[model samples]
Target chain A: MFYRTSGQFKTSYTADMALFPVRQDAILLAIILAFAWVILPLTASEFAFQTLLIPILIYSLAAMGLNILTGYAGQLSLGTAAFMGVGAYACYKLVTIMPWMNPVVAILLSGVFSAGVGVAFGIPSLRIKGFYLAIATLAAQFFLVWLFEKWAWLYNYNASGAIQVPTLQMFGVTVAGPTASSHVQYYVVLGIVSLMTILCINLTRGTLGRTWKATRDMDIAAELIGINLMKSKLTAFAISSYIVGVSGALFVFMWRGAAEPNLFDIPLSFRILFIAIIGGLGSILGNYLGAILIVGLPVILNTLPETFGIPISSATVEHLNIMIVGALIVFFLIIEPHGLARLWALIREKLVIWPFPH
Target chain B: MDFLNSLLVQPFADMFAAPDFLMQVLWEGLVSGILYALIALGFVLIFRSSRIFNFAQGIMVVFAALTLVGFHEMGVPAWISVILSLGVMFVLAVSIERVVLRPLVGQPDIILFMATIGITLFLIGFGELIFGGENKIMITEELGIPTGEFIFEPFGGFLLLEQKDVTAVVVAAVLVIALLAFLNKTRMGRAIRALGDDHQAALSVGISLQTIWVLVWFIAGIIALVTGIAWGARAGVSFALEVIAYKALPVLMLGGLESITGAIIGGLMIGLFEKLFEIYWGQPLLGGNTETWFAFVLALFVLLFRPQGLFGERIIERV
Candidate 1:
């Protein structure tokens, strides 16, 4: 069997500690990379790239950012959309102000602004815990959205009060704005997502991740053991915000193309939280799996009735879609509160011992 | 100097200059405060019994009102529609208890909270699919609630009070008193309080959790209907009313989650203060929509000082 580990043996501690301890995982990653990098872009249509691929990558990246704080660091934030808004608005201002700057650099740099804002809001987490802290984040959510609406300067005093992405070239290649092709945008999103995903995997597997798990499990005990609680929590916020901010920039510039302040409301935050929770919080791969399901489920449902030659209004389909998603959340939670990642792990376990009942 | 005066002195000066307008604002605040207390009371009852935050409480209001209006639209009499809506809510409570909450017993608090949000989304879709998303006018006149205005002349100044608001306050007060008596005097109410204190012990004492849960949720549903009618009367029934749920959260934070008295006092304080701040200070200095975050910000400040909230039981964590 492809997943069998019978012949593979780790001879050293380093070998055992390597990211893909099982040889099959590394090979699986290579195959996935091949599809993402080579096969999909070359074969898929513009609709597929726009509606599925690009959005999935961007959302996965955002969920990964949230997973760090809520999943790893034992902090709950319901204001992720506001942080994303900070990133998007910051990127918008950066490019508009410094038109000569590299678009990629502008997007990456936008995370710092969101990081600062994230830390400011995260201060309440030090004094509050659990749902109380979550509500504190809502204060940021509402206030920031209000700021986006009232502060004319954020949107450059645009007549419509929406941020419009302007055409920008990177090394003579159109990568963002209306003129950018879906293929180009998809690649940019894929590239940034992969880079961030690798960084997150490493950070989460290292010392900082261990510290976070300790803090999350029991902060008082973690403190007794000489862990610097403040440093751990704040660093979690800063890094989480940075990644989330970058994804926000990517969300707007690479995918949505235009956004209003209302776009970053509570519902958006809940969507991202859903991805984190449903995908299996604290797992890097879970973000992608979660994003795929959350983003792709509706699209598939929208087309299924048509493919079957059934007559259903689009509005009815939309309503059904919402109902199905809500039902699925409850179903998933009842069945596996740990999320789809755990489900995958179980399948992989069974696959490893397929021939034998044990 | 002028900026300082406008920020600090002028608002207070203006209040004294037109005492009648200030009185009207206070009256408006008290009415809204009472409504907020009603919503908070529903939350307190359910949280006390089940420890579920019930994020769906807001959507329940929308769904109940929609059901009432939908029934009337189908040619049912207004009073019958109200009764039928209560029946629908009862069915919803039983189904939710059986399908959702039963399997989720002993789950982490956040998981249960997430489940309620799931219920919220499901109801939104279900309600919209059945009744359509358009706003519907409340059957205020059909329900026999007066819609007239009362004008009071005092200090040689005119004060205006909407009769419906007066009706809302009186009805809410009566409902609260009735709810309090039911909880204190009834056997089932004591069972609910016992479950809130210690679920395992209550179960050991032969308390049927499923029955109590159904009852508690049914009561919450009834309260949701009243809130729906009162709020819908003010601003026609729509999914947009769901946003008011967020307003009750700060009240929960200020009052302890399990304390009914805390919920009522906290709700009134928030309702009154947020409006007062918005009119007197927020509009002039902060550009007016401060009502949005005012409650949350105040709650956060309160939480910083008293982490358990002003009325919540002390949190004792064990490692």
Candidate 2:
């Protein structure tokens, strides 16, 4: 079988512990990165780069962040969009107040701000579990959105009550804002997304990750075994929020270039949750897969009908898109609740067996 | 006495000073509460039987209302349209049971919940496709529901009450009583309670899961219809109604997901309290739109105090 890993051998622990242990995987990743950097910029239109690629990268980052807390830690959070809003607003304020500061640092600091808020909201998890915790998180969603709406200072008292992203430059090269080249913005987002993905993979494979899994699988047993519930849970929240916060910064600063409180409302939160579910919870690769399906499918639906000359109205297409996504979610849950990641894994397994019967 | 009356008691004093106004506000809150209770009832029925949170209940309300209006727009008689809408809801319930629920029988609670979200999205799309995605006025008068008003003069001031408001409250009360009786007296009702209590045990006792699911879903559909009509009569039938349906989420949180009585009590309390707060404090301090989130904040506090809610059975976790 072309997919067989039988010949793969590791001579050292470092090799075994590499992010992609298989040489084929490493090569495939390199090719993917090369294609993204060299080919996509040359071929992709401005709309494709801005709408399709940028948003997917941003949401994948957010979904990965959520994967750490809700997927790995077994917490149900409905405040993801709120946390992202915090990051976006915080970054906006930071960049405005200190024009000399680097934009990347501003983005990281914004994540720290979201982490603080995440811990405060996550405290309720100590007392509640399951749906109760989900409701508690909703409080954070409503409260944060309300605070942003009423607190004029957050938006710098813009007459329209929306935050506009200023042009971002690093080393005199425009990195963000309307004037920034699509290729520059794409590289910036791609760079951040890649780093975050590496960090998430490292964190999830470490001792802290084990503690999370332990807590998720059995909290009482975890406690007996010396895992501090508060510490582990809060840490998960902090890291998760930090990742999501960065995504928010990128979403507004790089993708949308403007933001309003309603832009990060409950529907956005639900959409991210759907992305996580359809992608496969807990799997790192599943985040990207889920984002592509959930975010990309509508675009595909719109284009495919046109290509076929079906003459569907845009409104009807939008409706049918929603129905198909809904039907797919139900179908996925019924057939493979583990998500598309599981389906891919199954295909790989079958390929490994080749022509031989099991 | 003047200071106390102005600060502490004037709000109620003002209400009584114009008895008609007090009656008007109270009637408005009551009618709104009944509609909220109807939506909450749909949610409670599904949760009671399946233990799955039906996020689509609000969409179902919109869908039912849209179907009725869509039928009317097609030259169907109002009475026939009502029957057709009911039939559509029945078909919806049966298809959902067969296609969505049956396949997802043994899934985790969260997955089932997510599937309902899928159902919600599908219904939203389907509703818009069929009904043309525009607001439609409720045919209240044509449906033989009164649109007359009653005026009361108290303390030399007049209060106006719509006859529709009166009808809504009375109908809701009768529906609640009928539901309570059905739940307590019927064989199917017993089976539903048993299923909610323990699925495996109910299966052991020979309850058909499919039949019970269909019946509960039918009941929920009926509740959705009633809610759609009542709410549509107030705000017109449109997707915007989905936002009002979200008002029921806070009610469910305060009432507990599994309790019908809690849904009723919580709906009324939130309805009355949010209106009162918006009028008295919200307008004065926060510029009045606080009604949007005041009930949710209240529910959040209630959850902090009593996670099981007023009528919910206490949950005991093992290990």
Candidate 3:
């Protein structure tokens, strides 16, 4: 009843190609957006902001970047955190070197650096396909991470070998650094995520997106059909890296407020990949859903034992979280390889055809 | 230029200056090479049978080592602890085949790979919970493996080779010979190779997929045990040891996915070259710790020319 589409008729191509052809999806998105933009911040405690809201947004953006490459383009990458490291470092350099520039501009431009590096790494992908490409990307992960550690210049030669986000004001409000309030940081993250998501949605829905799908489904066939596999695959890498870089910037400046070299290690890459896979590959909305589940569930699990008066240690809780997440990954793959987004789509389909059997 | 000389010439000069140190590096490389070969064998065996990349092979090593040590700690004899660990790995193999691999049998290679990663995480957590997160010493003395070093004097230079490393080499050689013989002589091994060759054709011949899977995984489990013991003997048993599993990836890439010979040769080559580069070239010219990316970089460069890996079977994609 909630998703019935009987009365909705498309009169033209523009109407047929609408982002949310079903009115309910738009309304649902509006409600969610309003909550994210307004109600969550109003009701959320500092703990909620720091742990759940901020992380979910940043991770969603990061996963979206990965989803573009892995899910949409059909390339597998195990080195997302390394690309993210590229973004974070680039953003840090941009800010430190040009202190007079707008922080948001610096953050956005940082993605360009990552995009270039992403393309450089992606060059190998033209020849390396499938799991081979995935392993190849680890070269980037290990090398770039090593560079981050060895090159003191990237971290501004801090003896600590970590980047500390500096306080920066955007339109008279401190948007980053220790002095920045969570509310302001949350808004900043939200603004960037929402913008990138829109861009990602449009990109994935467009011709280039179709090209990626073609390459992903069967590269030889796609090439036979005159699709330049190189261009398609490289652009996917570029755009995906750009979005990932932006999220990396947000991850450090907006959320973490401090960063270390090992922060962008293999484990972080695996975590993002989990979000992408569990949320559903090749879906924009899936990134957000996946991030919420991957990020939020742990927080909820941590609190659940305490709330229930269980005497489980925090370390035990952390272990259980890892176990559950692992089990969930297998469960999700077995039950629905397309992930939560696909699950939601199935439910929506059933609702759209309510009171009848297909 | 001095830079060119440092990059090119000095490393060779340094190597000639200390033949004993060079020998020491080569010995270090060979031990790690054996371990890498063992891990790669585990990967090859499981991948051949089920088409799953078996990322859990790394954690299996950790889990097996932990279980052996854990059982010994619980007052079981060292030999009994080995049996108990084997039993644990058998149960693990069965559960993984049933729970994880069964449902994901027809999924894409990437999905299967991801599933293996999931298995890795779960094993890491489970092992940590049961064994605790602290590093445990390998029961070398309990197992009666000699820990003394053997010294050699050649051309007025001294070379030190640990007895355990020598034992590791001998044991690994025997294991590999036994494994190759088993594969060639056994009915089950033939089934695994047939499945790797053609899944449907093998199924048509009345070979039980589940049994083959379970058997293959169990074998991988056995290899994992040997790897755990050998690696733990050197580095101690801990979750941190899981990082070396990544080393096996480059080995697999360099060796080829389906070839056992590829695994062994690739493992040894990567091990030796990475060590040599780290000492001769990487440490002096580049900053130290080049071991972190050296294997992967070498593998990547090799893969650019041969995407199937140097020893990998040719990949023929069909639309």
- Predicted structure with the largest TM-score when compared to the true one: 3
Candidate 1 backbone collisions, by pair: none
Query: Which stretch of 10 consecutive residues in model 2 chain A shows the poorest summed lDDT?
Result: A127-136
Off by over 4 Å in 1: none
Candidate 1, residues A26-88, lDDT tens digits: the string is 999999999999999999998998899999999999999999999999898889999999999
All candidates' lDDT scores?
Answer: 0.91, 0.86, 0.92
Query: DockQ values for all predictions?
Result: 0.76, 0.63, 0.81
RMSD of each: 1.2, 2.5, 1.0
Q: Is candidate 1 or candidate 2 better by TM-score?
A: 1
Return model 1's CA RMSD, one decimal.
Answer: 1.2
The estimated TM-scores of all candidates read: 0.98, 0.95, 0.99
Report the lDDT tens digits of candidate 2 across residue range A1-358: 6666788998999998888876667787798888877888889999898768888889999999988998899898888999999999999999999988888889888999999999998887876677767867887887788888988999998899999999889989988778988788888889899999989988899999999999888888899999999999999999999999999999998888999998988888888998888888888888999998888988888899989999889999998988888888888888899888888889777877787847
| Candidate 1 lDDT | 0.91
Residue A189 in model 2: shift from native, Å? Answer: 0.8
Q: How many pairs collide in each candidate, listed in order?
A: 0, 1, 0
- For model 2, the stretches where C-alpha displacement exceeds 4 angstroms are A10-18, B1-23
